[model samples]
Target chain A: MKTTIHLKLYAGLQKYASASDDNHPIETGDSVREVLNRLGVPPDKPLLVFINGNRSKATSLLQGEELVKVFPPMRGG
Target chain B: MNSFIGKMLNVDLTSGKIETVSIPTEWAEKYTGQKGLGTRILMEDLDPKTDPLSPQNKIVMTSSIMAGTIVSCSAKLAIATKSPQTGTITDGSIGGHAGAELKYAGYDAICISGKAEELSYLYLDPDKAEIRSAAELKGVGTFETEIRIKEMAGDPQVKVLANGPAGENQVLFSCISTERYRQLGRGGIGAVMGSKNLKAVAIRGWLDVHVPDMKECLKVAKELHAADKIDDAEYEIYTDGTPILVDFSQESGLLPTDNFQEGTFEGFEKINSASMKEVRAAKKACFSCAIACGNYLKGSKSDVEGPEYETIALCGSSIRNDSRDRIIEINSICDDVGLDTISAGAVIAYMMEMTEKGLHDFGIRFGETEKAVEMVRKIAFKEGVGAEGAMGTKKLADKYGGAEFAMHVKGMEIPGYDPRGSWAMGLAYVSAPRGGCHMSAYPIEAEAWGDLDPYTYEGKADLVVGLQNSQFAKFSMGVCDFWPVASDNLAKLYSVTYGGKWTAEEVDIIGERIFNLQRIFNIMAGFDGGDDKLPGRFHQENLKSGPPKDISMPEEAFMKSMQEYYRLRGWDDKGKPTLEKLKALGVEDRFVQQYETYLATS
Candidate 1:
């Protein structure tokens, strides 16, 4: 079974986002890092991942999460 | 002078005496250039608390040693003075040919002192430098000034850094617009120019900068430029310029609306990136910039170089002017008249909100662009309501009854970032040496797009402090922040350019010293715990509606970060640098004496 969650990828990861039109469908108990891997983001590139507008570690569970946002390294003022 | 030029053109406007002075190599080793070196000059020379408009107040225009190098984004000019707005050590960067041109003219800096007996403009070349009367050029718009001056001087290639009617009128928030489109657009640097009775600064370079190691410089430049092209897949900046941030700000719950009453604008799509591209005439680049994030949009209102994110958010969203065309028109008018768009939008929004609240009615309403548009002209000429508007939001709030929502820090109006949505950003706003500045420490990306928790209480200080130090270091080295120049590479490039051994660790240390000195300049000017604070709105109010709702600046979480930032900065509890910290950073004893004296006097 799969649970759906809102997902947004920005900066460098913006182009890799192909999870339907918007919210991503992921395994119910997928870890944050697992979701990133499933999305095909480069493993070595620095990223800031969020679960439901909150900073989430790679080990965090997504079972209860409803939103995810991933971002790539960006520098500007 | 070596490759650094190590010489400055010191022009005393009153005495009409221009002299060449040699800068000590020791100064370069310590402060780097621009941000650090410029601030060190101010701290050592002027009373940090000197009234900004006074003749006694000095302003320095310094370029980085790499400014004229083949390196991309190396053409930025740093201008520093006691600000009429922030009343602290205030500086901003102007991009385009000015810095590069000035550097090529055999001087690293053009430091202007003493007010002129008559309005004047400076012209410099490799052989001759003169202060010429600008009487006929008074009240001219910045763009026309550049064009007309070039015609008058018969040199189209000469770069002109001029203020608009606003600067000539001495509007407190007026900014210096250079390269026609780019600006040193914060803390009323233009007002300082006006106070000096100087109208415009024009320059042409006939000499080439001596690159000590061209091969190494080219290798690094090629790699950096290549990396920049692919740095971000979105490539929004390269494609759409900063207008790309409009939709991102709206979507991410960070768009400032109704003078920051809300975090989202309803008219986001109308002013987003795609719309800007439609009107974009051509892409623009700074002097030697490869990424060329600047834009040139052809609008029915007037062809403009911007309506960048700040203009869209401040004038369009916050002030309720939803039409992209209208925003572009206002942007053109502001540029033409020489107003800082951020402060102008902020001031107009404050007036609109005040009139709505019946606290004060300036015959303005939100979403009504006509009065505001008309006021843009008046503000530059100091005409009528524009006179009040020229004072910017802080003073307007002080007179009217809306200090609560004035949206400033340390008397400088804050930018487009909604602090409640990003805690670290809020900390950056309050603790910015120049007040409410986002650039020195842009950890907002961490919360907005990256790893830091936007709403969390912990590690914010660490993030802001780290970014601040790194950024100051970057400014010192005169590297453009937008370029894909890594710290390691920056140190390497600097080492090669200056023939000095600079390790990445040294970069961090030098950056810290520069950062600490800027803070010490503020502290010397009598800024205490009181100046390091957010506007009344952020502290007491939450966004009424947005994706990031119920978010007010959590005082405890944010304050903890501020304290941590102070600690990391090696400052005492009162936000003053400790003696030990000063010693470590090599802040001179004379600076300490001045700091203590001003601290006592103020």
Candidate 2:
């Protein structure tokens, strides 16, 4: 069974991958961390990854068809 | 004198008399001037039961020993009094030229008490102090009043701290605006100022804030200036301003939306930092600060200094209004009307939710925000529903019946953080002396995204307690909250500016002592461990949308952490400072004996 997840990079993280290149798709058995690693986001930069509107992690396993979003950390106010 | 003016003015508005008094050296050494010393004065002089809006309530304005010095982020003025909203020891921090100017004018602090017979303003020059008739300035907006007073004083550099129309009407959330942008923006200090019938305090100075070692002070300052630029990569507060947090918090599930019913707003993209970056016309900073995280925006609504992260959360996302331009305009209006944007937004959102729940409507809907802008003026003037809403969230909830989800702690509205998303902030909010404030201890950097896990209570108690102590100590020195300065750095700066080897450990102890002192003040004023809890909505209900869906604070974990935090503070399980704890913190038993007495009675 072939299944895939769509990845959208936002804000400062867009420097890695943006809509100009369009979102890349990852299949089942691939985790969010795998996608971030491919995009060159450092593990220590406090980046937040959300899978289909839920707080996910770099190590979170994708369940295919999930919309994975990534961005820099939030602070203040 | 090494930055110690050692003098304060006591103005009794009712008698129209002003007296200058010497600030004892021992008191200055123990409390470090600004927030710490101001709290000590309030604890000693004020009756805990005094009505915050009454003549008995006193407003003490002081600067830290660092003010007017070359130290980075050193110019801040601390305003302390019983909050009309929280009924607790509230200290509002104002950043701008005013704090340093007040110091340069040869006074370390100004204590204003009693209600005046008529409207007036305090005029302070380097050599003279007078209470002048401000008949023409009555009921004017803060911006115009500051400008008028500056022109009247004939000094373009005169620093004017003025209350706006909202303060005149005594709005519980009224703020004191300074330099047209910086504000003592929380805990209703302006209402206390207005109640005294004092319109503004304009200061001009011709002296310098002498430091013990100017060479070493400038050297440390240069290092801080260089270090602040390093934070630009992770926080980027300088480049994009605060709106940058919008998208990140939304995705991370911390952004409060629709009166905190949800953790994310779908309308986020339209009003996030990218939009603020596009509209930011200029960058601004307060006093001699280097981080420079401030911005002035020219959006479709108006040209103003930011709808910061909090305003963006409350006005932009909380009510489902995603128009960045409108939010910017609303921020400007809020400034002019003297309303703290956090409370203003929260109260309006409460009314909007009330309308949703079949309560009385002021024609407010989830996504409709234009009406609230009009109500901003009405709130200042005390007109229409603004009369009820200006009373703030707790009062509005009392009138309308939403006690469970009023979203306030001790009458102050909660800021942008949805505690469900950043669990440590829940503890911070509960433990804060001035009710629901995020500035007290922002633990999200560590607990939410840094080393510690955000889900469990494992290290959160230690994290929050430590942050609170450090922050309290930092603010005691009138250090601006925007920059990141380690405790060691603070101690070195203290030693260089003041005299002596003020160790980092001593600074920590001073912070802890100040925290306990404020707690003792609250204890006498009737706060207990019982007050250290969040709104029922946060504990019982769950966030309905986004990454933090249906997640609520775990009861047992929260309780465990709270208890541990108590132990760290040397407090009992009920959050009262034990007599032994007071002794260890160097708080004289006589100072806290009243609180101990209050505990015995209850």
Per-residue accuracy of model 2 over B178-258 as CA lDDT, tens digit each: 988777758788888888898899998888778877888789777766765424544556556677788767876788888
Question: Could you tell me every candidate's TM-score relative to the true structure?
Answer: 0.91, 0.92
In DockQ, how does model 2 score against the reference complex? 0.36
**Tens digit of per-residue lDDT, candidate 2, span A1-77:** 35666777655566677622333666677877776777787756666667777666777887677887776654465
Off by over 4 Å in 2: A1-74, B227-235
Fnat for every candidate? 0.30, 0.43
- Candidate 1's TM-score: 0.91
Instruction: Write the residue-wise lDDT of candidate 1 on B223-280 in tens digits.
Output: 7667656334355566566776775667567888888888888888788767787888
Ten residues in a row with the worst lDDT in model 1 chain B? B227-236
What are the DockQ scores of the candidates, in order?
Answer: 0.26, 0.36
Residue A4 of model 1, lDDT score: 72
